[model samples]
Target: MLYDIDKERSALVFIEFQNEWLSDEGILQRRVIKDLDAFRDAVRTGARIIESARSNGWTVVHAGLDLRDDPDYLLFNGGRDVLGLRGAIPRAGTWRDKGVERPAPFAPLRGEFVVAGRSGASVLKNSTLDPFLRNRRIDTLFLMGFATHVCVESSLREAHDMGYNAYLVEDACAAFERAQHEHVRKHVVHHFGAETNGAELIARMEG
Candidate 1:
């Protein structure tokens, strides 16, 4: 059966599609970029998602990556990005060397009802987003965007504990490889407790 949700009360989260993240010079693994056109195509789908979310007056928000002053998060913080991620979402100043920073462009809206587009294996793993969303009483998250296995899976798991309904857009997202995408999508929806994608998800909301 499909999820019959209240679109007016829902939100769309567009994770990590920043210029820096998608550029030819991104900080992502070289092979990771290979399977990204699906995500690119998903952009058009995501745009529709955003427009529909906004049209319904559902909160639409963007979430990528960032940190503050911690050393442990250096890799994700831009210290050891193999693709020279400096051109990606999180900046050293914005992310951390060993700690967490406020989610830029997302701080003020943090406590409001919304969605997340985070890209990584753990969007809310060690971040303050879970608490932030809970405080806002926002209970549904439409997970859409890139690098599925990594960030997408991460956020879905956390949303479970954060007590929000998490939905993954299979068509709206892509993993690092055909294999990876299949694995993660199957695992999460079949075993991890996330709503699997149904093309009509976008349509029902638009109605």
Candidate 2:
């Protein structure tokens, strides 16, 4: 079913598009992403979505995880390391690390909101994103980006709990393995929100 989206009440959120995850020299990319070409393809699709959003006057947000100042692990002391590196992932100085930068296609524009201070999987955690959305009265969110099963999933769950209508752009997201992405789409996404590809989402926005 095609839902009528109010562009004024919707926001397109890009999560974890940092260099560390997408670029060749990125620590997470080198360590986790096996199919670089496939991941890049997803990012390209994301770029097209962003362009559509911009042209349609939809709100744009870029959420990034920057741990440059968490030397004491105060913000990341969960001890449930999923990366299997024993809490070594998202290394200190990641904020200043070259990997923290967004890829050229995903970079935020002059007026676009860039949310930071995210030290965890969920973009809404410890970040002003929730309040930012609330302030703008944005009720619908279009989310896409790296690690579909991780950060994107986390945010989808949280957004549901927060009463926002969340839509996951499946083709605009990627994970270390194709199976991981499929698992989220098949099992996780429907429970929290609906799934739409970049093309469908853009079409909805334009329509």
Candidate 3:
């Protein structure tokens, strides 16, 4: 079913899209740049979504990965590692630590919402995203960002559980692997919310 976005009750939560994942020299991109065309397309689509949402009066939120002060978040704390993220974790201020600090293909415009200074997979977990959403009375959420099967999926599930009607902008998000990307879009997205393309979302906003 195609859901119409009510501007007054809707919000667009862009997860990640930070320099560490999107930039050409970023760590994750360096590891997966060979297959990054899809991811890049997703980011571009996300940018369009933001533009449409902005003009349509839908709330915009930037859920960034700000791990600047807490470098040992994943290493030391086992309780918070619900995602079971293993291996070397990237710390902010490092050579590979690029987030909203530097310009990438997308950056938040002035006076827009930003939920920065976070280390958790879900923006709601480590940031004020939940409170902000609640404060704004935003019930419908349009989600987009990097690592579709990881952080994006994690947050999607959380949003669903939180009783928000969420939509995953599939073309506006990417996984590390193409298989992973397709897997989440095919199987997992429905479990949380409807999967939508940028064009459809933009059309809905424009309408």
What does candidate 3's lDDT look like per residue over 1-207, in tens digits? Answer: 457667888888888767777677777677654567888788788878887877877788888766556555543352354434433353223223444453533577776788854555777775788888888888988889878888889889988998988888888888887899899988898888888888888888888
lDDT tens per residue, model 1, 20-118? 344444445343566666656665576666656555566665666543333354445444544443334343333322222222332324334332433
lDDT of 3: 0.74
RMSD of each: 6.4, 2.7, 3.2
Clashes of 2: 0
Pairs that clash in candidate 3:
none
**Candidate 2 clashing pairs, residues 3+ apart or interchain:** none
Off by over 4 Å in 3: 71-83, 90-97, 100-105
Which residue segments of model 2 deviate by more than 4 Å? 71-74, 77-86, 90-95
Rank by TM-score, highest first: 2, 3, 1
Ranking by lDDT: 2, 3, 1
TM-score per model over all chains = 0.68, 0.89, 0.85
For each candidate, the alpha-carbon lDDT, in order, equals: 0.58, 0.82, 0.74
Q: Which lDDT value does model 2 have at 85?
A: 24
Candidate 3, residue 140: Cα displacement in angstroms equals 1.0
lDDT of 2 at 94: 45
